[model samples]
Target chain A: MEELIQQLKEQIIEVLNLEDVTPADIDNDAPLFGEGLGLDSIDALELIVMMEKEYGIKLKNPAEGKEIFKSINVMAQYVNEHRTK
Target chain B: MTHLGKIVITPRGVELNSQVYPTSQIGDALLTACYRSCHADYPKFFKMDPLCRLGFIASELLLQSQDEERFIPREDRAVVLASCNGCLHTDRHYASTIHAGDNYFPSPAVFVYTLPNIVTGEIAIRNKYLGESSMYIVEDGLTEEELVQRLAELTFQDPVTTSAIIGWVDYHDGDHYNAILYLIQK
Candidate 1:
């Protein structure tokens, strides 16, 4: 889980073009949107694409994104369980 | 309309109201250097394409010359930008992404900036501007003075707009990009 979370952080930073951010900057449980990382709607879409491209986890429902992308910890846990690749 | 201030950015250097920023480094680093010179804190600036970067930096410097904060929200202001190339640079980048093969993922970040007018949108979002704004791909070989006149006419056409950051923001590559913005107010 720790390894996956760190990997997710790096991937998110690269995918979102968050140039100044590092894996250490993002807290494991901090919110990815609104208050924590301040990611907007476009960023959310990019994250979705990143998940599919990297993890082979096709998010069938759009609503599931909110739960899956809550944070690096939640995202890593979800991907670990559901990712086919 | 009355001219409040003006900013000129080019490969040579950046000039705001005759105050020249030293040409420390040119090309890709120039825009970042300009942003850093202002000591401004807008993280989204890094994500913008070169065209948007030129416009954003020009507008920021233009506003600063008038002793105004670039991020202040206002409804009476507008942005009228004209570009010669009109995002061909980014179009080439977006095209590279959709190539049919094992790699066919088009980046939404780069896709959002495919239009020339997206610069206005980015500027609007940054400043919370709820006023008239537009982007034009100018066909005429107008001189700098002529462009100022053309932009002034566009801004004046929108009666609701009391002021505007109007100019040409052209960027094709690291070697070729220029933005000259004038803050004009009624």
Candidate 2:
């Protein structure tokens, strides 16, 4: 679980092109959108695409992402449960 | 048709307001070097595709020394830009990612920049210019005459537009790029 979270942190930074942010800076339980990382709608779409491409996890409904991508911890847990690859 | 400011960024160096900037460390990568030289803390610049970055830097240079609020408000200024390639560089990059069926990983980050107007959007987002922003794809190349004609058409199109940032920003391949942006007061 810890390794998945760390990997998720690295992937988030790389995929989003967060040049100034380090993996250590992202708290696992902090929200990924709004106040925490301040990522917008575009970032959310990118995260959705990343989940499918990286983990072979297809999120059929976009609304489900609101809870699934609430935070790094939630995302890691969801990916761990549903990831095909 | 009064010119407020002009910035020309070429493979050689950058020329801002008719004065050639120091091109010491700006060897071949002129746009990247110029962006670095500006010392602006816009991290979103790094995420933009090369064409958007070119337009972004050019617009920044044109607006750097001006009192932007005096002549144009957020909704009064329009960005009318032209480009030859029109996101071809990013299109090719995105294609490479998806073409290899077995190894296909289509990146949304790269895919989002597949439109030419995204450059205008980037500038608008950066400067908070909520006015009309448009990009034209000039396949052959954009001549000065065509640019002027386009600018005239854009200015007269809307009564609300009083000022505009007009330019030809083209990026081909990775390193081949050129931009000539002008701030014009209508």
DockQ of each: 0.64, 0.57
Question: How many pairs in model 1 have backbone atoms within 3 A of each other, for residues 3 or more apart or on separate chains, i.e. clashes?
Answer: 0
lDDT of 1 by residue, B1-186 (tens): 788888889877898887886658788788888888876688788888899888888777777644456457878888888889989999999999888777777788889999999998877777667787789998749999999998889788877888888888898899988888888888
Candidate 2 residue-wise lDDT, B47-103, digit = tens: 888888889888887888865553344798888888888999899999998998888
Question: Model 1 over residues A3-80: C-alpha lDDT tens digits?
Answer: 888888989998887877899999988999988677888888788878888988877776789998998888998999
Query: What i-RMS does every model get?
Result: 1.1, 1.5
The candidate that wins on lDDT is 1
By DockQ, who's the top model here? 1
lDDT of each: 0.84, 0.83
Q: What CA RMSD would candidate 2 show?
A: 2.7
